[model samples]
Target: MTIAHSLGFPRIGKQRELKKAVEAYWRGKLNQEQLLAEGQKLRQQHWQWQAEAGLDYVPVGDFAWYDQVLNLSCTLGVIPERFLADAKQIPSEVGLELYFKMARGDTNEQGEVAACEMTKWFDTNYHYIVPEFTENQSFAISSSQLLEEIKEAAQQGLKPKPVLLGPLSYLWLGKAKGSDFNKLSLLDELIRVYGELLVKIADLGVEWIQLDEPILTLDLDNEWRQGFETAYNRLQSTPVNILLATYFGALGDNLGTAINLPTEGLHIDLVRAPEQLTSVVDRLPAYKVLSVGVVNGRNVWRTDLQQWLERLQPVKQRIGDRLWVGPSCSLLHSPVDLNQEQQFADDVRQWLAFAVQKNKEIAVLAKALAGDNSTEITAAIEASMAAFKEKNNSGRIHDETIQARVQAIDANMSIRQKPYNQRVVLQRQQLKLPLLPTTTIGSFPQTTAIRAARKAFKAGKLTEAEYRAEMKQQIADAVHRQETLDLDVLVHGEAERNDMVEYFGEQLSGFLFSQHGWVQSYGSRCVKPPIILGDIKREQPMTVEWIRYAQTLTNKPLKGMLTGPVTMLCWSFPREDVSREVSCLQLALALRDEVQDLEKAGIHIIQIDEPAIREGLPLRKAEWQQYLDWAVRCFKIASCGVENTTQIHTHMCYSEFNDIIEAIAALDADVITIETSRSDMELLDAFENFEYPNEIGPGVYDIHSPNIPSQDWIKQLLKKAANKIDLERLWVNPDCGLKTRDWSETEQALANMVAVAKELREEYQAS
Candidate 1:
């Protein structure tokens, strides 16, 4: 017999019930009890949905108020002493408030400590708070969220496999506090805490535990490699069966070390690197199970059932009943379900499967492998095959005219009109401005009024003319505000956009969207990425109307905002049948036309944001250059079509870019803005080492936090930035967009930012 299971489930809820409930609590609309009840309801809904799909084992501990890694950090009592000390006087029941404070800092009568720094989770777009460790750090089992969730799953009669981030990976993903110290030095104490947690799980009488150690797939040294051995070896005494899982890449040379662990099973991500299977099957131990992850959890494309069945048949024959089949990673990265995507057309809808449908596909595959070949199982396979065939030969998949243009592309389309040196000179002459030019990264806050108007328009409560008038007023207000603030460059405020990528996708051919298919970009931040199905083309002007209108209002020279091709493809779920390079090139071609149109509309400074380029890089160092080569090319193709004086700018956010400085230079935008405020000017070292020639805006304010920086603080950051960059090349801006921020804070923060820039200008003049 074969078993079907899930590594994890999406926590944002089907219709975004969790997001609404959480936001309501933050807004003081709901009490703590109300919010807890809502979270409980969402967890039950997700678990029952998976159980109904015939999964043998459903996962618990996947629900997070903010992030899963933060939950683990809090549960293990690895929180900083500052938060614990702050919570000493608070009531015991409100201890979870400390957890929330650690993830997103809160203020009271006492002094405030900022929230822990956040970074990209592995190579994915998901953000996790970095666990801070000190030399005297200690660990203990303090939180009961996991154990309580386990008991709750038992009440639902579902066999719960509580998922925990493996200790090795958790330690590897974190950083040391303030000073340089070996983070792995605290591994022993961390394993002790895990041992205690496992003992409790054993007491609950749970059968299997899923230990996610995704970092094992990365390059490891001798000490860190040996640390994995020591940690799991200590946990071998636990009664619960351990399923050590590795995903996002292959085990590669670590296969021997991984298989040799004294555990019940080892799960490998075959969806990413299928070639690792032969070696995994060969090294299988007789007494242990071998879980093969054949289904994709990150993408929305329907699994090729027949292809997966063929690959797993031989494995089932070898491993017999010990095999457990599931997604290659957690379903947390995917949308909730395909059935919720009612907005999709029939022709395109048949080719996609979200998180819920993927579970059913796994169940069907397990039955077929177990030789239970019922008519239902046979029909599922046949339908999947038909969907694949229809999607392959669809007339919408290609455009001969677009293909011809792409093929005829030469050196001219990929290169700017002038190199950085010549272009900067021409840009300065064309747009006379101050030394420290200030601008926002293309968007202002999307207020409740804007969201309500968009909702009304979608629901037919308002006419098209009414919607246009309202959004235009919002843009006019944005222009007026920028003039009041006296900023150098202005944006159209993007009030008409539901999202940057999705808005452009709505104007282009070959993309589909959902009313409620929201995925978490970070804490309380959700994005609905359009699904790219066929060949892409700009049917008409996407940004010209709003940008042209805003340009009329501001003599500050409006910066035409657009999401770059690489970011669009990286953010959206591209078709499974196409290579990313091909899909990206098609997107680039579509944007090339948009770029030319925006220029013709009298927009001088166009900002094409590519924050996802670093997120889309391959995990392995050996494969970075291959992916970056095309990614840079795609960005260039999208932004390089205009003249030198057009002044193209790009923005990157919330990433460690030390490794990709050359690729950053390769995009060759006339100006670039990066998120450096959170890291305290350390990110400038990359630009300093590269001696980056183009103008730069090292963001002076950390946009992610509501805690505004003082003018003195901002000036200090600028002083540090001056050491690395030339005075003429420096610009002033916030780290990213202010969409999530409210009007009051946005005004206060930008006011502080402008004052900081003026003070810096005074210093430059006196010198």
Candidate 2:
């Protein structure tokens, strides 16, 4: 019988129990023991759920209180300098405080910490804690989390296949505090620790361990090849059957190196990079069991069993007896079970499948290969094929009028209405701003009280009218506070929104909001991404009421905040039936109307953020331009309809900007704000090199932390920014929105920000 395995499961639980419990603990409502008990119960339930789904190899150690990478950091003693316990004598006690500190970070009673530096997890929206390395970095599997999980699963009569981030990926994704990218000296020590971890798991009688080496998908040179060899060699002594897994892209020449790595099993994602099947067949070791990732993992598309079988036939001929079929990667990205969606149109919902339904896809493909002709499986596969035909080439895809309009747009559409010179003259005169204007990235702190109110409103304790009144009050107060602070710009504080994407998704057509769909975007922070079910259109204005109302409250330039079309499309669970560009354009046309509405509302300085722009880039460099072209076009379409002096501003959260500077410029925003404090203004280097002409705000302080920055620190940042760009074009602000912070910090930070901006204005004028 073929074995079915999952690389991991969503840890947030079906109803987001973990998120509730963790937040409860942070609020002092739950104790450490209560938190641990909740975690254990969640893990047990997940294991049972996977087992009931008929998985042969259920996963363990994948559920984490914060992040699995942070857990590994704790186990390996790679704790950053600040999180390290000061006394050192009670090193064993450091586990609890250190882990939370690494995640939430230690701050005053106001909630601050030395914020953890977060980075992208292998091209997905999910973030992992970037491992901090020191010369004194030590390794020990201190926690019994993994072993306990395996033992618990065994008690439940399930054989668990534990998943681990392979040493190569772990080390490759890490950074030394102040070292060059070429630093490979830490690799040797990191691998030694990983080898010991393998030994520990083997000692616990764990037979199959899934070692995910996703770095195989990246552009690798000779150095990475040697690093892989050294790492796997040290880990080879363990009796555990290593299932070496690679996903997200094609293996190419890395296939030969992977096949020779002395692993007992090799897993390749035939669903993502299906061209790798030819290579997998050409280079299989005699004793190796091949786990073919045949089902779609990253997409919402259902598998065409007939097409999958065509790709599998050649591989099955060589290794049929030793073959296993599964999802191309973990089903964590896909929503929970499709059976839970009751509100969707029956026709559309019938054509969809979530994680639970996907398991059936894998199982049916396995049985079909084994020659089991069950009617249910056959009917399901047939329906999927029928749906694919209906949806892909459906009448819903193209609008002749929309297409004509898009085609009619010339290069001038991408250019602003009037040149920057004329627009700035009007904007400055209208706004009457001094040098070094101060503004925020368009959110105030989302406090516990506000969260409770929203949660209450969601549960129907508060009516729609009541909720709006409450949110309006919060917005009114936020605008009132900003005016009192004498800030140059103001925002509505966005207390009305639960999420940047979900807020707009609620008002848009063709999207479904889940009652219980929660996925971890990072440590302790979960997002409920809206699923696009069919053709999308705007039913009504999304942010107009909030923006117009907030504008009524303030005399200052109240910026109308909206999430751009490309971001709304990228951040949501997009429709797989059509090309992404088509879906993006659909959203762009809708937002274009909204932008015009906001301008009509008499709101100036409209900020449309595209934080996911970098996250949406294709994994391969050769294909990046195709994505960038459509992405920039979508953004331009959204912003172009507004008149000159409207002052469109775009904000991007933490990302590497050097590679896409030209594309960023193409967005043609009057101003752009980007996270720069964490990178030490290195992000601005791209603008300097590209000779970017637009005004810019390289964040003066890191918003990811609670560390209250002094006025001097902000001044220093402004001074450094002034050195690179013209001082007249600089704006001062934090790296991101202040939603995750407390009111005290938010108030103090802005007050300090304004002070620093004032000082800069005086100094620049004198110079």
Candidate 3:
């Protein structure tokens, strides 16, 4: 029998109930019991949904309060010593405080302790806690979260395949802090703990366990590959079968290393590397089951049912009962369901699928292979095939005139006439700025009042005139507050905008939005990325009025905030048939028109944010150049038309810039600000070592959390940043935007930020 399996499901509830509950806990409105209960409720709802959807293999232990990696950190005793009661404690009363501390970091009412470092999770928008290890690291199965979740699934009458990050990948993903050796040196200890956990699951009569080793997709050294051999050798003694799962990209040479492993089953992502399947089928051991990841997991386009059946039929015939159909990776990357997006046109909506819909795709394919040839199912399949055909060659998706314009793009269109040295002189003269000028990233807090007014306007309770008046007031207040805080550049606080990217999408042609099509960016943060339905163009100037209004209130340079082209593509659900590079070029042209409008409207300083740029990097090292080449090209198309004095500023969140510092320098912005507070200037080493040429604003304080940084602390961080780059090249700001934070923290953090800049200037002058 063909079994339909899901890698994982969305943790945030249908209405984002989890986000509300988590935020309430952070604000002291909910206790630990209430929060835990909410988490349990969400887990049950997700499991029941999968089971009812007729999925044969439902996943357990994939649900997390924060992140799956952190959950794994808790299950195994991979915790740093400070987070636990005792250094040698096996399990000393694990509570909510201990778990939350490791994620957001602990700070007293007076605010002191710093957050642990966090970075991008393998180029995704999601952020994961960096596992801090030391020489005295000890391993034990400290917690029962995974075991208990497995038991919970059994009680719910579902066949649970417990998913775990493989020991090799876990050790490989973590950082070795204050240690002189490789973190993989402790791989044996970690594997021992995993083996013990696996034995306990087998004791519960669980037949299969999924060990995800996504690190196989990355470029690995021989030692790392050998470490995999050493690690799985220990796991061979476990009673339960190990299903080694790998995704994100092609295995290439890693295919040989993976198939040769001593595991009962192997799962490879065919949606990304469909070419690998033929090679695997030819060389497979007859006894081992092969799980084929045929359905797309990371995108939104509807799978062509006919094509999927054709792709899977041959594999099912070769493997027979050993074949399992599944998504290419976890559905955690996809939205929950397309059914909730009722606001979209039927034409566009029919051509899409979310996580739940993806599971249905798996089920339909599995049943088709099982000889269930009912008319209803056959008609459904035919409809999906038709939708794919319509979407692929739809006139809405492409315009030949736009394609011609894109093809005609020249070298001169994507570059500034003056170099950074020359541009800076003109900018300094025009702006008359001080050393280490301070600015906010783009937005201020979009408080409850702002949301309420916008909601009222949308629902027709308030008139458009009234809403505009309220927004203008908010903008004036934002300008007044920045002046009182004594900052350099100013922002409009984005009072009229809902999101940085979504605001632009709403004004541009060829896009559709959803009423409830939200996907999780990270913990408790859900973003509804607009669906690109056709070729996009700016109908009119998107932000000129807001920028012009904000500038009229300030003598200081008010930045015209815009979301860059690559970010627009990376953050949104782009059209599937169109190549990503082509879609990005179209967006670049739209934003190019907007940029020129802003410059013409007397808004001299423009900050086009590409925070999603690094998150869009392909997982494999061999593939980075191709992505960066087009990504850089699109950004230049959006930015380069302006004069030198009209400074271009860009912002990136907490990501590993060290690997792509040259690409960052190539953007050639007048200034760049990045998140460095939690990483504690570790991110600045990339800048210092690269000798980054453009002006930099390495953030002085972390803004994601509510923790307010002290001016003294900010000064010390600036001094640390000065170590890597010349002081003249530095700017002062918070890590990211202040949108998630409240007014109190935003005000306090920015005040300290400006004061730090003043102190640094005085110190530099005196010296």
Candidate 4:
């Protein structure tokens, strides 16, 4: 019989209980015991759901209080030295505190420590804590969380399969901190820890272990490939049967090395690269189990079960009992449950499936493949087929006017009227500014009163007029604050907007909102993304009124803020029926209309953020240009409609631009601000090497951490940035928006930021 299992499940509860509990713990409302209990409850509930779905084995060790990668870091004793005074001490005593501190920095008698740098997980919106490594890194089995979880699952009478981040991928995902050296050089020591970890899981009576190595989808050199072989060969000696899992994209060249690894099974993602199925089966050993992921894991779209069964039939025939079925990747990228969305249209809701539904789909696929022709199984297959067909042909999803507008897009629409050199001159003449001009990334802190008023307004406790007054008051306060700081530029503070993307989606047509569809973007930070069900088009100006009001309040140039087309698409659950290029172009045209309106509204500066553009790059190097070409075109379409006097700015956070510096330059915004404080100004080397023509704001403060950077510290960072790029074209800003920060931290940080700019300006003039 074919096995049915999952790579992982969404740990955030259906109503986001984990988010609430974690936040409560951080705020001192909940104690450590209560937090651990809450975590256990969530883990048990998720495991029960998987068991109920008829999974052959319930996956343990997938649950985390913050992130799975950070959990693994603690499990393998990879805590950074800053968090621990003594390197020899065991971390488990202060495990939870150490973990939270590593994720969100801490300030104590030991002064302040910055958190470990974070970045996107592959092509997904999920953020993982990037592991920190040094040349002399050592590993040991520290945290007993995974071993304890396996026992808990076994006690529940469910067959448990422990999941772990593969050793090779863990090293590959990390950075070399203090001294530069090959991370792979430390793999022998890392595998020794993994060998011990596997033995512990085996002693817990676990029969199978799923080790995820998603980096196989990326281009790798011979040494990294050889490291995988050596690591797994050492790990294969453990009693537990190993299932090597790869997802996000096709294995391609790595397929040979992956299959040849001394493991009992291999999992391939057929939803992304189904063509690899035949090739994988042809070369696989007959004794090894081949788990084929047929259901979509990264998306909410329902799988066409009938079609998938047809595709899997021949593969099953070749592999017979060795064939297994699951999702394309971990369902951590998906929302918890589709059943919680009570507000969605019936037709639209039918076309969707969350993590819970996806697991049931996996079970149904496995049963059908095993020739279980029961009435219930047949009905599920039929329902899935019907949903897929209706979604494709639904008149609600297609709009002729929007389609025509997208089709009418021309190359001229994607080019600016003037290049950066000419445009900067016009912008400077139009709005005179000083060297190292200080600005923000277009949002002030969203405070408790602000959140309360918005909640009250949404709940109908306040009228539209009353709500507008409250938001206007907040915006005026923000303007006064910026004027007080003596910053060069100002922003409307985005007091009226709930989220950068969701705010725009609410005004646009052809999108669906969810009441309880939240996914974790990073630790304790959950985002409820809008569902893109149909063609996208803007009916009216989204940010004009708020921006115009703020501009009137301040003598300084206030930026008109808008989320870019690529970010709006990549961050949301985009339409599967249309090509991304078509959907993105449609969004670009809509945003283009808004950009022109902002120009007309007397706004001199506009910032359209494309943070997800780098996140949207294809995993395979050979396929990157096709994605970059369309992504750049869409951004240009949104931004290129403005005049040279109207300075266009863009912001990106927590993304590595070294490989895509040319594409970043091609966006052609007059100024670009990025998150560089966490990486300690390392990202500036890319812009400096490329001799990027436009102005830039290499962020001087890390807003994600609550630690207020001192004035001298900000000045030193500015000095580092000045050495790399010309100070003439440099701007000063924070790493990202201050939406998640409190007002006190925001005020102190901006005060220091403005001080750094002023001091730098006077010093440069004197020199």
TM-score of each candidate structure, all chains considered together: 0.97, 0.93, 0.97, 0.98
Pick by lDDT: 3 or 4, better one? 4
Q: Cα RMSD for candidate 1?
A: 1.8
| Selected candidate, larger lDDT, 1 vs 3 | 1
* Highest-lDDT candidate: 4
Per-model RMSD to reference: 1.8, 2.9, 1.6, 1.3
Summarize candidate 3's per-residue lDDT along 1-767 as a digit string, tens digits: 88889888888888888899999998899998999899888888898888877799789888877788888888887777655553547473345677777777666654556756677777666677777778777887767888888888888888999999888888877887775778887887888888889999999889899999999988988998998888888898899999999998778878777888899988889888889888988888888888889888877878888987887788888889888889998888788878888877778888888888888888888888877798966976898988987777667777777778888899999999899999999988999989989999988898999999999999999999999999999999999999999999999989999887789999988788877777777767888888788888778989999889889998999999999998898888877666889889999999999999999999889998998889889988788999999999999999999999899999998788788999999999989999988878888888767878899998888876667788878988988998887878888888888888888888888888888789779989999
Candidate 4 per-residue lDDT over residues 1-767, each given as its tens digit: 77899999999899889999999998899999999999999989999999999899988888998899999999988988888865556565447888898998877675667889999999888889999998999898889999899989988889999999999999999999899899998999999999999998899888999999999989998999999999988998999999999999899999999999999999999988989998999999978999998888888888999998998898888889999899999999899999988887788888889999999999999999999999999999998888888777788888899988888888999988888888888889999998889999988889999999999998999999999999999999999988998988999899999889899999999888888888889988889888898888899888898889889897888899999999999989987777888889989999999999999999989999989999999999899999999999999999999888999899998888789999999999889999998888999889777889989998888887879888877998999999988988999999899999988889899999998889889999999
The sequence of per-residue lDDT tens digits that candidate 1 reaches over residues 576-661 is 76688888888898888888999999988999999988998998888999999999999999988998889999999988888999
For residue 491, what is the lDDT in candidate 2?
Answer: 90
Query: In candidate 1, residue 694 scores what lDDT?
Result: 88
Would you list the clashing residue pairs of candidate 4? none
Ranking by lDDT: 4, 1, 3, 2
Error of 1 at 706 (Å): 2.6
Q: Where is model 1 poorest over a 10-residue stretch in terms of lDDT?
A: 86-95
Residues 1-767, model 2: lDDT tens digits: 56777777778877778888987887789999999899999888888777777677788878888888887777676777665445543154335656777776566543333567776677677878878765555665667677778888888888889888888888777776755545467777777777777788888778899999987877788888888888788778877889999998888768778889988888888766877787787788889988888777765556777777666766677777678888888777776666777876655665666777777778777766766668976776688778777767656444566556555656655567887768888888777877888999998989777888899997999999998888888888899889877889889999989899998888877777775566778766788788776567778898898889988876778899999888898778877666788778778878888999999989878999998898888777878999999899889988988878799999997677589999998888889999887666878888787898889988988876657877777777788899898877888889899998888888898899998888778877997
Collision count for each candidate, in order: 0, 0, 0, 0
lDDT of 3 at 441: 90
What is the alpha-carbon RMSD of candidate 2 to the true structure?
Answer: 2.9
